[model samples]
Target: MFLIFDNFIFDLDGTIINSSKEVFQCFAMAFESVNYDIDKTRLNPDIIGPPLKEIIKLIAPELNDENKINLICQNFRQIYDNDENDCSELYDGILEFLKKLKKHNKKVFMATFKPMIPTIRLVNKFKLNDLFDDIYGIDKFGKHITKEEMIEDIISKYNLNREKTVMIGDAPTDVIAAKNTGIFGIGTLWGYGSDKTELKKNSNLCINNIKELDSNCEFERILK
Candidate 1:
């Protein structure tokens, strides 16, 4: 079962940067800026990976209309964009892992659903841009870049062999994206999209920590 992927595409949110604390803080700041006086502690958990507009609609269900959702979403961007000093930080051990992947000669890139603008900001804000060779993120859904498509784009962007590219994420969506392109999918247990049961279906395998990924290539080759 041993197989090796020469290229790897990764998800940003729960998979790499555990910015729950800062995200929560930013969500609260956004609403407060809009005169809503929202509490981040309560709203933070829901803001993990989805777009701010989606989170705004979920949190401010009372304002179900489109216009209000847009406004609140704008508020969110204001807060998230205002400061990078607090909103983005790589999860501990991430740098070590990325360096290892680089040393192994694996092409590494980020293929996240996170909008391109903020994704760029977050990477540079935290000085993570150097670790990745390419960054493929979409600004909006209807722009024709399906989340899954980003995986394909990254694989092709680097001219990677389909059998040698892996997509590592925390959601079932990640699995669909990877399989859509005949690539490998690896899930993380420390994220929001999975419990033990869901893990079995969505990924070729699941891992608990990035540090555990020291032996990841061996496991991925076998599992896939």
Candidate 2:
């Protein structure tokens, strides 16, 4: 299964590193600092895949004011970015799997909803720069874009063959992006945002562990 694709695009937060703790903590602090009341239950790990503003809306739907939303986002960034001790850790077997892909000369890239500043910070913190061919976030500039658009940009920029490219992620958005861009999507079960039913329905293949990508592990495939 792994040999079929020459290129792999991965999601960052839920797919590669588990940043749920850091994310939730920073969001909580941000909301408190902004005097916004939120349901703590809405701050679960499932909300980690989308952009900060989207996540804020989901967690605090009552916040309809654009100015307030922007303020909260700014506060969250200040709190999260300045925290030297980010509790994000790579999922088990991820490092080894990435190395295996590199050894096989596969082209690997990252397409994360996280902004470039913190994305680069995490990549550097984890010492993953050498493993990936390139890394991308929601936007390099202030332009608003969808995850599908970001994926499409990566495909076009690299001239990746759709048939030989796969997007591996833990969220339905990731699968949807790959589908929208005409590439294969591999759903990972071990990540924070994984919804078994949603992923099983949308993904070309679903993997339980990162090691499965290197082995002939049995996977659930939904033929579209």
Candidate 3:
């Protein structure tokens, strides 16, 4: 049987919900609002998993004005945070897997770099608010915290056992965070970060399907 963990920390963007397209659209809208010409082709899909500040810095390095960056970021959040669900969709089997975790008495939490307001909105919109024990988003004061910091904080706040905790995410940053925070990391291939070599090198386990979270495959097991 797969090793069952007591606490599971999940990443929001590519892991739990497919919000990359919406993210890109928001960026586009933000540029339009400021009459800044944005070359849509320059926006990479891999940019979705990182913090919004990082994304802005990467995509618009020439826009050095902090005020402008904040304005764009705010505009992006405003458009994407609306009640209407645009392109966001839950990955196949995620809802069912979450239900199973809940039934198994697992403590679920979301650790995302997305701002708190929009993150909570999406969680509630997807009707997933009840499943998570706690949610960690970027600070309201615009302080950008790393995934490692967020995971460490969660561990301390919840008094979780490091030996029985796991981080589930789709990016290298997530794996790094789990490793830095002394927890097992499970990388999902179905999401945006499909680099198996990178994931296998960092994560304790890597799963292509949600059901594989409980797989008995010897190769997939994290024996610790």
In terms of lDDT, the best-performing candidate is 2
lDDT of 2 at 88: 85
lDDT of 1 at 173: 73
lDDT tens readout by residue for model 3, 84-140: 857788988889888867877778999988888888888878899889999999773
**CA-lDDT, candidates in order:** 0.71, 0.84, 0.81
Q: Where is the poorest 10-residue window by lDDT in model 1? A: 38-47
lDDT of 1: 0.71
Listed in order, each prediction's TM-score against the native is 0.85, 0.90, 0.88
Tens-place lDDT digits, model 2, residues 61-138: 888999989999999999887778999899998998888778777789998888888999999999999999988887
Between prediction 1 and prediction 2, which has the larger lDDT?
2
Model 3 CA lDDT for position 127:
95
What tens digits encode model 1's per-residue C-alpha lDDT throughout 83-183?
A: 64764567778788888777666778987777777778888777777789988776544463665778866666577888778888776677678877888
Candidate 3: 10-residue stretch with minimal lDDT: 215-224
Between prediction 2 and prediction 3, the one with superior lDDT is 2
